[model samples]
Target: MPPLPPVKASDSRAARLVLLVTAIGLISLNLRPALTSPGPLLSEIMREFGIDTALAGGVTGISLICLGVFGAAAPRLARRFGPERVILALLVVLAAGIALRGTGSFGALIGGMILAGLGIGVIQVLLPGIVKRDFARHAGTMTGLYTMNLCLGAAIGAGLAIPLEQTLGSWRLSLAAWALPALAAAIIWLPQAFVRQSPAPRAARPGRLWRDPLAWAVTCFMGLQSCLAYMMIGLMPLILEQRGDDSARAGLITAIAIAPQALTALAVPHFAARMRNQSAVAIVSIAVSAIGFLGLLFAPPSTALLFAVIEGLGLGATIGIAILFIVLRAPDSHVATDLSGMSQSVGYIIAALGPIVAGLLRDAGGNWVLPAAFFLAVASLNAVAGWYAGRDAHVLQDPES
Candidate 1:
């Protein structure tokens, strides 16, 4: 089929497009910190709350679960109220959740994270659809930009949260500091909610993607890969600290592990778009991650830092591809919306278990090695899923009707 007609827009639409890209970039930066900032400080939080690692896993797991649950609802919400208005509202919700987390109460922190995750969930599901709609011709490049900023956010949080907490003399202030960015994003995004969406990217009937086997393949590929990425985000520092690295050093190692992600996140999508199929890239990327992770988990302590950068490269590419598939596998923006919702909603729920499972294994076995085994297995499964999902085909042509 011929490519969907390019968006023919008024010159004003060009101006709007520039603003939308900026808003999207800023919003993407906000997405990861709410989840990542706490990772570097997990030991401190655990000490303050007197909880074990398994329970600490809940800090990230709860948010992941929220992503799954609320993500499922985003498409319906967008369909009713329109994506822009809903995104503006959710940005406010994200800011509120971040501020709530600064309250320093255990209950408050978990509750805040849930709220933040819910907000993130909805926005996450909706933004890609907007990207696919507005930036159809440059989906891969735009996706790279978005994911690059997202990983940059992750690296910033991992590297700075601990230091910021130390410098501020209060973890609460450090945690709450993230709220400023979220609010700023909201302010920038506010105009979008009111701006013209004429020639809007809507289908008369945007159907569910849950029924298609290809959609499931894409979802599993996204989820299984995320399982590894989020697991590292949620636990890598703690695991390093346990190995006797100081908080600063541990955080630095974790930062190094993820810093490369920002680069790969941008570069991979650009390269993947040139491939015949993503299958070869998928297996190779996952294998590279497994090798790096195994070295980090079992190799000499001195090599951990080196292995981390390797792992980061693999994780970054996988995530970029997973997201690209959401757009590529679907026939158009409408289906992309449902596919994004389904893949992330279901995919993140699957990912939510990664840390919990790793936590349990560590708690029971008294080492990170067991979790390494888990990561390797998940990486293999992710490869298989990616192979199937990477085919050059759409999920199917018709709506449920």
Candidate 2:
């Protein structure tokens, strides 16, 4: 028999690329759902388990800390098992985590969240590298799509939690339903692990990342913006409830705010890429979000949804810009990898503090004003950091290295 023709091989490669992109999209859709779903149902979770506000906040904090710590380990896992395999394995674990969380025991809930967080962290760390490898010329577009889907997923997760609970008659069941999507994503991703694998790139040296002022600026911006984002996800529903909204209504309100993020998330990166610098965009986005927070704090309950929309749009753009900075400021792929590791690992750990603080303030003062003030302060700092990071300059290189 004649060997396969070159044209057919090329077509086969094309087909595989399409499948891989599909897999990436499906996986991205799942990342935020697991992270954000608990927020809308958090009140119920707390009541069911008799957990306090701070401990409820600690749920998000626990997951975030795992995201930071396990993310640092993901690159190593990918290198050992291959990126595709690691991702596939992680998806399965994510499914298991989501399922275990529905067991209704506090220990199971926390254990499940830890596993889910680790899975998400590892996959998040590896995805940009995968995009660069597979969609090099179109990395920006692919990443924009990924970010947009992440926002959409968050919106859906937050919005659906209450409705799902009402329909299913159990909050546990509602949470467990998310496992289906994770399983579906895993099935779609399975074929990629069998594809030809490349040797992992050399590990980046950490010395330069530590010395670079610009990298530090970028990291701060990333962390600060993440602080606001996590606060919105973990605390917004509760805040709205404090302002006199019911549980399901508060969840939908948070969903509406996050839903607009999909729009800005899709648009910001593309337009930012065309600009000379992204400083203005970054400032504008954070300012808009901060204003929303102020309104939520001071304005009447009638205006909450309007402020949420404003906040969501700004937040969507803020994060899009933050992720863009990781790619835009890096001098090369190795540097991008190191920058991503530093920003997400350190940044998310910093972000983890936001929810904990919000929870503590809620417990201490029993009001949203202090929490809103905390967010305002963080946003201000993020704006300053963003201004520096968004300047059209690469990270400063080390000398005598």
Q: In candidate 1, residue 318 scores what lDDT? A: 84
> Total clashes, candidate 1?
0
Local accuracy of candidate 1 as per-residue lDDT tens digits, 1-401: 88886666676678788999999999999999898888888988999999998889889999999999999988888878888988889999999998999887999999999999999999999888988888888988998999898889888878888888989897777777888899999999988898654234454243445667788999999889888988998998988888789988998899889889888889888788777688888888888888888888778888989899999998888888888888788778887888888999999999999988999999999988789889988988998899999898888654442
User: How well does model 2 score by local distance difference test?
Assistant: 0.85
Task: Identify the runs in model 2 with alpha carbons over 4 angstroms from their true place.
Answer: 1-10, 396-401
lDDT against true structure, model 1: 0.87
Q: Kindly list the per-residue Cα lDDT of model 2 for residues 1-401, writing each as its tens digit.
A: 99875677788889988998888888988998877888988888888888888899888888888888888777667667877888889999999999998887888888988988888888877777776666766656776787888899899989999998899898888888899999999999888877667566556666667778898999899899989999988988888887889998999999999999989988998788778799999999999998887787779999999999999999999988888888778766656666777788778888899999988987888777788788989999999999999998777454553
After superposing all C-alphas onto the true structure, candidate 1 shows an RMSD in angstroms of: 5.2
Evaluate model 1: give its TM-score: 0.94
Residue 255, candidate 2: how far off, in angstroms? 1.0
User: TM-scores, in order shown?
Assistant: 0.94, 0.94
